[model samples]
Target: MSGTLALVPAAPGKRLGAAVLDWLAPVAILTVLLSFGFAGITSTRSAGLIIYDTSLLALLGSIGAGLALVYAFAVATVEGRSGNTIGNRLMGIRSADKDGYAPGLGAVFLRGIVTGAGILLAVLASVLVAVFKWFDAAPLILGPLLLLGTAWAAVVVVSSAWDRNGKLRGWHDRAAKTLVFDVVNGRNPVATGGIEGPYSFAPLDLPPVQHVASPVASRTPVVPGPVASETPVEPLPPAAHAVHLDTAAHPETAAHPDDAMDRTQVRAGVRQDAPEAVLRITLDDGRDFRLERTVLIGRNPAPAAGESQAQLLPVPDPGRTISKTHLHLLTDGTGLWVTDRHSTNGSAVTTPDGMRTALQPGVPAYVSPGTTVHFGDRTFNVGHA
Candidate 1:
């Protein structure tokens, strides 16, 4: 590839945030159910005081244990099917295999089980010990088990950061052979070599032109013939000659119409013998949109009177962060060119070298493969098919 390979790792803070969100819903549901059940069991004593019984405490312990098990199973099932939990989807990150494809349901399930079962078991054990007052009787065993469980949980949380390859692989990821990537800027997993690499133009494979020379003995002696008078042709100007030489050297350039010449197409057409390049943009939500000659991007765009054309890409922006007509992408030959349409939040382009430049409205920017473009809070990367 023209640029070095860079894996887009989801920030540790975002990962933690997603995990918290994922757990919140189940915890809230369990807490509400337990609260209502406990209210019915508690007995009102003299002076409006409430008395709790051992049975209520035991029920609380059972509820906690049951919730833990349910949470683990639910998370695993969801993640296995979609490679994302509710939190991960909200944070624009997802799990994938090493090559960038979605880690199948089996892998995701295994990861969820490995990372969650131990922690849930520990929590369940802690609840049982606390409710039954067994910790005081077996402090040695209970204390050690609690500590080990806490340590395991902590290790899983930070394991991705500890990976030597910077692939953002946690213990669950390693166990399942999965990797977490920021969907916005991650490299395409299925593309050949991940991205299109730099290549030089070579001569087309054509049969060698054969020139047959006349044998000297077979040549006829020159016989004078009547000369025919005609107007002498003038030589072409220097500029015209130069243009001719250029067209001859790059035959693909001659095929494109004059009006079709653009920076993106010109560069892409340089290698005429190479396969036609395709442009693909992958969204943070695991959606891939292939760009045609013209692409319109925005949250939504209303159709005006007498305008029958529908928007090319009408993305749903629940936060109202993206503009109605944020930007436009055009396929210039094999490459892509993006132009901001005076968006309210503006837009930015991140080059392959990690440098970001704010885009000016109406000015087109060539987006190379592996480069990312950000529009408001959303982002997409340009890649080859």
Candidate 2:
């Protein structure tokens, strides 16, 4: 509830700057290559082929325009919508729905199609005018007009940054109800807004939307796997990788082997039933914690010292002892463990080296199989079914 207020507004100017940089690089490179090409054409005369002509300049112009279109559409629409493209990513900008969720693939495809079409149309118009001049013997005005129009369109696309809300606008942004915003510190929570003008509506406090490194629940069903639910759950970081412990068949199963497949096999073959509980922890990494099979241990029923002592989840299950302080236990056939659901005294974890660390209420601790977990002097060893 109490935190600093910062707005992650979109930087339309930065994005446009990046695009212009990208556009110029290729043009410079192509000009160099074309210069060489033109020299070769003049230096060597070949009867077998139609030698170089001023018309070739028109061909080069078309090629340049086509390249520009492909670059813009692909980078802006496809990459921008899904993951920030090279330009946007380098510029520290991201795109999302008016509500602040990731944009759908449809948005990406639409942007690509429209932007690409615009680029090509502009170039084709220029080419047609040139051809007309040759045939009709008219003044050479149409070509410049087409070029100017195309450049103006580019300007429009880039100017979306100037919108009051700091959101980008394009064909896809309008159709898919999305916009781009800067993810200052990677802490986007929710999306809320409207779609008007070019950019989508901005949320009151535009937090940087965080992304899950691992796959979460989603609407589209993957071929064979878990569907990511829409809940705001962040993936566990590698540092927090729970050391696999088992409490199934034996009290002491050897530590996991190097081979992942071998470890999976060993875990599947052992381990036992675990306690049932769900504690939601909102971590500093902007992820919601959903833990199961954890046991809270305390005698006085108040959170004990060094045990998770804050926001202890109230269990509704009638079978278990009901109290303000509870222990959650989970067994993966290997080890039974508990995590502190924010208790007052804090959850204390016994390290393998025989040292105990206070598991703060918001933090989680792993209790190895058969390891004596002491919470408020109430010692309990992991048990199997």
Candidate 3:
């Protein structure tokens, strides 16, 4: 329900790619552990031994449980601190809240719990089957339960592609209200404009250009003159002064009246006559930011102990949707341009004419006056101030 939900979501392809990598990592680790354990057990087995030792079975069980817990804890810790796991980092994506801010540790924990729920269920079912194996009827029920747990986990992951909002969110993400966005495109969703509702604009019509004839030409008299043969003209006498008619002296012959006063002062390659054109970005909460030169917009990076705050413009993004350095804004006397600094959520521009365009990463786009620039959910209006 927060305004941050308006922020752009990550692509589904990236989400699935990252998820596969993350899931495979733990599986790889567990496989290695199992392999080593299997080799040790194989070496200790005797031809005369009809049954395996209970201690070995217990050790194997312990290893399985430990691996599962380790996988869950590792993912939770990594995401809680920086919203990036091995898979997320590799895929150039990270998780955040709808507001494009970092979800707190609690949310990360919840997400991890939900993500690992299926695995945990399968493990529980296995434990139950092993403990109750003395009862011949137990496997019949526990086996189906284990299959169900595995199915549920698959459903959880596959369901991510089914998000109606196209956020590519899984049950874990929905439970935690978290979103995954590309590393170079994610931005603070809450701070972007137009979250309250649809914006209504009146039709804008510019006056048509008019070309009028000069009053002098209209009033000039037309006289018929006799055709004469081409003849050499004599030069004027030195005593006869030449008359030069100045347009300023004869208003009737002047073209545009305001042309004389329209001159602008040029300083250091910039025009200084008119008020400096600036982009005034006003947040939905009434906070505003003025972009003059170049500004780095994003969430503040984690500061070191006793370190002063960064010089960058920090937007409040509790969802962790905005990158530490989202994008760069550059402005001149003519217009403003925005460049995506390889953020996770990407940036966009909405023109006054109601056209929305996505900006390419590392590419700078000119923002027309009265246009809205969106960085995730955060938005700012660009215009002459």
Ranking by TM-score: 3, 1, 2
What digit string (tens of lDDT, one per residue) describes model 3 on residues 295-379? Answer: 6678764323442442357776534446677777777746777888756567888898899999998999988677887876567
Candidate 1 weakest ten by summed lDDT: 192-201
The parts of candidate 1 lying over 4 Å away from their true place are 1-7, 25-53, 127-151, 187-385
Instruction: Give the winner by TM-score: 1 or 2.
Output: 1
How far off is residue 309 in model 3, in Å? 22
Could you say which candidate leads in TM-score?
3
TM-score computed on alpha carbons, candidate 1: 0.39
Model 3 residue 374 CA deviation (Å) reads 24
1 or 2: which has the higher lDDT? 1
Preferred candidate (lDDT higher): 2 or 3: 3
Report the C-alpha lDDT of model 1 over 148-253, residue by residue, as the tens digit.
7646755675678777776478878889888776765654322212112111111234344343332332457564444444644456679979998999999987
Q: What does candidate 2 score on TM?
A: 0.37
Q: What range of 10 consecutive residues in model 3 has the weakest lDDT sum?
A: 194-203
Tens-digit per-residue lDDT, 95-201, candidate 2: 66654444655665565455445555644554564444342232244345545655755665565655544354544456556666665543331222112110122
Error of 2 at 289 (Å): 17
Q: What residue pairs are clashing in model 1?
A: 1-197
Clash tally, candidates in order: 1, 49, 31
- Model 1, position 259, has a per-residue lDDT of 40
